[model samples]
Target: MSESRDRRAQFGWAFYDWANSAFATTVVAGFFPIFFKSFWSSGHPAETSTLQLGVGSALASLVVLVLAPLLGAVADRSRRKKPWLALATGLSVAATAGLFFVGEGQWLFALTLFVIASAAFFLAMVFYDSLIVDVATPADYDRVSALGYGLGYLGGGLLLAVNVAMTLWPEMFGLADRAAAVRWSFLSVAVWWALFALPVFLWVKEERDADTPSAGQAMREGVSELRRTARRIFDEKPVLTFLIAYWLYIDGVHTIIRMAVDFGLNLGFGETSLITALLLVQFIGFPAAVTFGWLASRWDTKKAIYLGLAVYAAVTAWGYFLAYEWQFYVMAMVIGLVQGGVQSLSRSYFARLIPEGRAGEYFGIYNMMGKFAAVIGPLLVGVTAAATGSARLSILSVLILFVAGGWLLTRVDARAAPSPE
Candidate 1:
């Protein structure tokens, strides 16, 4: 573990998050929502457009819930996580680049691209995250996890800034159409992702292959293994407590991402501001995440997470009061501070609790809980928005889950967590 820390291979491994986040920022959070509404909208009224996004998110979450665990298990067993990482990265990059061809009135095409891109991104993360347990010692887990998230925020923030500049100033990129600038933004993410991602494959050596089993055989066994691990861990009080807590909070977090754009759009922020603000969170997240990461090591990591949730709850409350664009900036900053920190540390903490040998199988079911909870967040927001006809009020709905999750997180016994071998 000491040898792995600060080694180029381990650093390279973390950089994969940096590499892939360009797509996550520019495509997922930034301009793609505009592309969906402007190009994809078939004049099917507000509810339908919202539903389409909801359904796509739900589908992506469903796929991720199933695929991430299997991939994690297979990678751990096979000792060959990189190939899967590379494949997922390639698929994501390709899908982001392909967004250029999806023009106005192409909502279906845009949704398809989103489905592919999101699935690839989330799938890649499972294997990437599992690598952390393998790479970092338990003590250094906090720092390693922090660095990965910090780099991701920096990378994602940088690319989104460039895309924002391009969108706001199309002539500089030699494109006359502003929409063309948007298209170019997608291309940039692809290039940035593909180029930056190469370092890991070059530097980070992969684990020994689990075994050479036929793909079909692995799938059958993986599913069986998943169920066994789920049951095994369910009986453990600490594991069950943490899983339930994680499920509840992560649902609110995922909902915020899926709904932010739509919510902003409904609030009448232009595509440029909403996307740029999204980029702001990425940059804001960079330093804040690092600070929170450092602080986690000194204080209780779960307490730090609880603090983040409190901030999120406050942000949700503030969102209801925001009537102008200026408040959005303030709230985006609030979001920046806790978002990455909460998520990164939550993952790092969870990794501490898993047995080393079955990390793959366990994390798979973990992904399922994360993904399954995702369905409720957006669905609730959509239902509430439609029922109340108030996007501002809709933001408040997320507060309940975060507060509840925070309370439950207190139930997790951190001392009992497994230490690195």
Candidate 2:
């Protein structure tokens, strides 16, 4: 494919978000947690189910956290994120499809998904994220990333809505029962993910600035690049500081993202109410994410991030006090309003400090740190919950991370928002 200079060409790139997020929606957030509880009961009670689900998720995350960088750097040097993207998305889709076959007492089915599905999902994100730098210039990256995040929310939400329709009215979808309807919801994600994911491989050109390297060459350089980027990140105080803050704060953000459904379900919300409220978040989050991007272009990016964090704190505290499922819906709306904006701005901010040629390698490290923190947050949440016998107390641990992260973020200067030359 011929290279095009127009930024709008990047629009097709953002559609990748619109493509794959259905998995995150129906399979990960909206349906699977509840489905797992009901399906894996083995006649055990709900709390036991939560404990098992938490452990499965943490194990899956641990795999991705360890391998994302090596896989990312190899893909970058090979100059084709599309192939890796295809492979990862394919694994996720296959796992989603397989979910249809899982049923009561199918604990191994859930375990299979936790391993293959989670690994593919997060590892695939490393390449997709490296594309942000490839697809957009600095001037446009804020909105481009925001657009991707927004569309992701929109796409994921749309699929979840369909899943909800199918689950709540399974007779209309030709399903046997509500549980079967829930199983079919996983099938919906598989189809949606495969169908929409074609544009990137079709339209987005992968340019490595030289001949594509072989696996041996990529691995040789991949290791070297990792070491060099690690040094650069640590030696540069501003980058180091921002990363520290980002590491800490993003822990809270991702913790909430991974655990929101389980949290709601634990609070005794009905399955329908939980999925419905989560769906509402996916839709509401779309426009809100875009709006935050626009606002960030005008305000200081860090300040914009701070605003998002502030809103998060309020929502968490409000959640701690909630008595009804109504509070979950309201808090979901509030989270949707700020979640994408904060995440998009943070990605863009990190992009600004990273050098051009090393985008993939650095983004790999970024992903490493990102997922490493991701690993810890859930582990902490799980261990704390198990020890205290209280999810409410576990929620407070996130507050400490947020405040410490914000304080670190305040010290990092956003002085290097330059486009790669």
Candidate 3:
């Protein structure tokens, strides 16, 4: 059970990020909303459609928020993290592949599948995050987590580039038009995601704890353990404070990532600009995440995270005034500079705080906070836009979250955790 660095196992784990990021970049952030609004919800008003999209995202996140902790607990107690991860990933792949059949005017079907796929994606991540403890030691957690995010940027970005080409130049691909190309792109993600997930499934081993009770007893004990876990977290001031800060700041970050393209669309920015900006974020994000890993080794990890939050705050402020397409590109680049940094650091930082055997349970709580934050960010933006009838104003509201999160983060003691072992 030694947590020595194993390059093959490490790469296997990191490849999962490469595998699933296709869904994040292509389907969720890039084309799906565009397709949903222009095709599926064609007849609906802009405000109504955006609101509905937010509602769907919120619902999906909420489902994950509720279930993540329970499943994480189960995975830890039974030492069945891979099984849970496999189940979630398999279902998500199926749902993503099914998107090929959701033609125009099928908003209900499209949104339903999106929700199912998104929830599965986020839930699967709980197990994946927990596995960091099982794979890499605490000393290398920052590097390892950053490696995964970097691969996510590169892998997701690469596919998105191909998707953009297929969408814009459908004739070259011998497709009917952009819509047909988009359909094929969705199918491609299914294949890409499932294919790259095999390495981890084949190579990484899930270390089981000492002989536990029967399955039924383990589940019951898991529930009891969750109650104690809650109390333990509350008693750990540093972890509690960090979670609160993360909950607030990441809400703003996720909101911006999820809604940036739609907001630009509402401003009448052309599709070319929005898509190109997304590519910029993805490509820049790769190096930026790796750089943050190095920074964490020099500057304190928490300090580096603070710097990322500062950049996010600036991005939020700039988002309010975004008018020209070039301005959007600038903002997107700035976001790329810090997006992966903050998220990767947060995961590694949290990994250092939790008890070793309870990694799944603790990371479950971490994922729940993230899922719950996702719920709020989208809802907030949608409500603001619906009320003001201006997407620009909605972008400004995210600033409050960053400001609050940063202030709370200053109170967290980065070195306040017991030995993770």
Candidate 4:
């Protein structure tokens, strides 16, 4: 690839984050939980709806956890990451669009679509993350990865703001009511995701090697590769430790993202306040993510991550005593400062630890760990809320994950070379 083409590819690749993050912002973190409880599971008790949402999220993570590593290996061997990414994106778009048609009091059906959309969304990321190696050299990984996340925040935030406006004043948008407006938001996310996703497929070229195998052979060899990668992860202490740390802390992050609205609802905060706070996170996250990338370059990547984790720990602790709507906004601002930073830096940092020419397989494991953590985090909050019947107590469960994960991160040697095959 020429120099100009490489920059285009990087931009195209980063834009996928811009594309799919609409689903993250508009559907997953923004309106879905509010709508699911108030609209879909209208009569259910608060705790019941929380548990249902948690189970749905866990189920989605479980599906991706099982499939990501193997699918990644097959894509790596077949040299077809883009096609696999396309398939996942298409499925996710369809599933998200399907949500627009789900009727009131159809919580089960709504949850089903959400699970499909969420799973497909996560699976697409496996290929998306792996493709970083094709877009930039090792020296540029931190900047390029952060660029994608920064764009994600900007793009997702922009659409979410529009969606929020539609809901706040349904009449202005020609909608019948707030419920109708929320449903339309789901449709908008699907269209936005599909429309922006096109650029990546058109402009970003997947790198191929001469040794790429036939479909049948790839499937057979992919399973063999999975085993080797698993063993390799174990033999490499730094990679193993970093993954374990990521698993622990990221669980808290995922839990917080998925459950924050539910937590506020349980504490009697209004829907408008909760949604507004989420928008705050997105806008603030845009500049913060880009700044973290620069900080990692000038300071140290691991230190930057540690700063994010420390703030998260404080946020988790403060959440237990959250009283007023204003405090929630304050927490959102604090979280916005570090949310994208922690997540983007983790990706770039891990990219440094993995072997070349096998990003698909390695990032598969990386995403698998993330999904596995997702499984645990939501379930922990759900089970705690259900058993104890205390939303405040449940929020405290995440503090341990951040603390433990941060401690374990100290064991990792970020500068260590990838372990040889």
Candidate 5:
């Protein structure tokens, strides 16, 4: 019965990845840029629309960076991670659903909704990630994290395929045209995201603190706890070094994910190839992500992550030389091999380092570091593209981040350091 319950809980937790990935694949990655340029910001130059999108993304990341640690600290003190997750998820769903109503020539309205939805998505992930400690043991962390990411790829991919079909063959779906189909696709994402996310709130239960403090007192203690967590993180050299390494490489990884489709389009690769490439990533990533987990169990976690970083460095270099659709497809395949492994191992590895009671606070910093990378990645890519008048050169510029991140990763002592929090 205990084993059965654990299995159910684990699946429930993993489904959140399935649920939320609809947003990641369909909205943010697959369709949003194309929709923004072709419809919402129609008549605007592609470069202008791309810069605007970057600004909106940066704004969303800034909000998450400011709020992640504070809200995480409060949730830690209140023992209310699930509740906060629910609230953020709700906001995200609502904002995503609202996107269906954003008509053409309303780029400002579109940006507003996108920013709100993006912020909510990032905020909810902090709570969800902290729950990793509650659901699985250290021994299982790598496998379980990989499972979550694998399922995410599957779920996100499935939905994106449907959305792509809708865009390509709207009349078959009883829609008026591609525009209407895209709008409905946005609505479907909201439903899919909300429906799949329900299992986490329903089936997974988190242990609560026995002592209840007043709201004000909890806030005060949370601030103090935040300080302690920060000190603990810095004082522990291994984790700090890993985070610095993660910040740099993950920035490059994220930059690629965010800009890949846009970069391809800018290079005159038509929309079909870009969409096809997106689907390819989702399917390929699922198995590759799981393979990384198996590798981690047999090998050192740090070593596995280093291997992922090395692949990403190569992927960036390949991106600089991409001149054909086949090459883009090849790049996507390589990305699938390493993306999930690196991210999953990093999360599970960090979970092993943090103290038991402060997972929320510590994961807050983890998420913040991720969001901070969002800010830097887009800015770096956008500025480089703007300055060079060539997106290919911009791809080359990202190699610096991977190199620096890989070098710093070597500095982190492979021994797991105990958290003093």
Candidate 6:
């Protein structure tokens, strides 16, 4: 590919992040929980709603965990990463849109749609993350990965700002009320996701491997390949170690992102304040993600990741003692500084370690570990909250994940696998 085409493909791939992140910001991290509690689960106790949300999140992650590696393997063998991505995106968009029609006091219906959308959203990433190899050279992995994340934050943030405005001032948006605006926000995310996802389908071409198999053949081969890859990962010490660390730490990260709003509510913070704090993270995350990419180029990737993890540990610890809304905002600011940094670098670093032409399969496992961690993290919080009835104490359960994961990360040698230049 020419330099121009390469740049175009890179941007096209990154724009998918821009597209889908609207779901991440507008639904997953922003309005969904609030709506779930106040609208869907209207008469339920706060603790009961929190448990339901956690279980719903864990269920979504669990579905993706089971399917990610298999889908990845099949896509790899069939050479249909883009098609798979498209299918998942379409499903997610449909599911998200369906949320708008769910009636009040219908938490089960809302949760069901959320699970479907969330699962599809995560499954789409298995293909999307793998496509990074098609868009940029190995040497540019960190930069390209960071670019995707930066765009995601910016794009997600922009749409969320508009959605937040609609909720705050429903009359201006021609909506009936805040609830109507929130429903419209869900519909808006679906449109935004479908619209922006088009560039990737058009421009980011997947490289075809020789001897691609038929769909039926690929499914049979994919199952066998998944078994082999499982063995290979275990035998590869650095890969295994990094995955373990990633599983632990990223669990805390995912949990925090999913649960922060609920936590704020539990602590008596206003919904407006919590949403604003989330918006703060999105804006700050844009420049901060790019900066982390630059920092990784200057420093060791592992060290940069360690820095992010350290900050996360501190944030989780501080969350336990959080007393005021301002403190929550401060924590959000600090999290924004490192959230994208850690996630982007982990993707790039793992991209370097995996063999070529097998990105889909490897990143499948990568995402699987992530999803598995997510399962544990949310359940921990839910179980803890139900057991102790103290949201602060439940928040503290995440602290251990960061600390353990960071320590395990120390065992992985950065030089163990280097991408070919």
My TM-score estimates for the predictions, one after another, are: 0.88, 0.88, 0.90, 0.91, 0.92, 0.91
Candidate 1's error at 255, in angstroms?
3.9
Cα lDDT, model 6, residue 309? 93
Model 6 over residues 1-421: C-alpha lDDT tens digits? 8999999999999999999999999998788988999999999999999999989988998899899999999888889999999999999999999999999999999999999999999999999999998898867888889989999999999999999999889999898999999999999999999999999999998888678789999899889988998987787888889999899999899888767766787779887787789889999999999899899888878899999998988888788888788888998999999999999999999988887777888899999888776667888888898999987799888888888999998898857863422
Error in Å for residue 78 of model 1: 1.5
Instruction: Give the alpha carbon lDDT tens digit for every residue of 1-421 in model 3.
Output: 4434387788889899999999999999788988989888899999988998989998998898788888888788888888889999999999999999988888999999999999999999999989987678888889889989989999999999999999989999999998999989999999999999998888788887678666787688778888888887888888898899999999888888866777688779887888898899999999999899989988888889989988888887788877787787888898898999999999999898777688888888999988767557777777898999987788788887888988998898757774544
Clashing pairs in 4: none
lDDT of 1: 0.80
Residue pairs with clashing backbones, model 5: none
Tell me how candidate 5 scores on lDDT: 0.87
Compared with the true structure, what per-residue lDDT tens digits does model 1 show for residues 122-216? 88887777778667777877777888899999999898888888877899889987788888888888999999898788877655654666667
The residue-level lDDT of candidate 1 at 204 comes to 72
Alpha carbon lDDT at 72, candidate 5: 90
| Residue 63 error, candidate 5, Å | 0.9
- C-alpha lDDT score of every prediction, in listed order: 0.80, 0.78, 0.87, 0.90, 0.87, 0.90
Candidate 3 lDDT at 114 equals 91
Across 352-372, the per-residue lDDT of candidate 4 in tens digits comes to 888877888889999998876
Best by TM-score: 5
lDDT for each residue of candidate 5 in 1-421, tens digit (9 for 90 to 100): 3988888888899999999999999999878877988899998888999899989988998899988998899888988889989999999999999999998999999989999999999999999999987789889899889999999999999999999999899999999999999999999999999999998988788988678676788789899988877877777888788789889989988888766776787779987887888888899989998899999999978789989988888887778877787888888888888898999988988888777778888888999988767556677777898999987787788888888888988887645667443
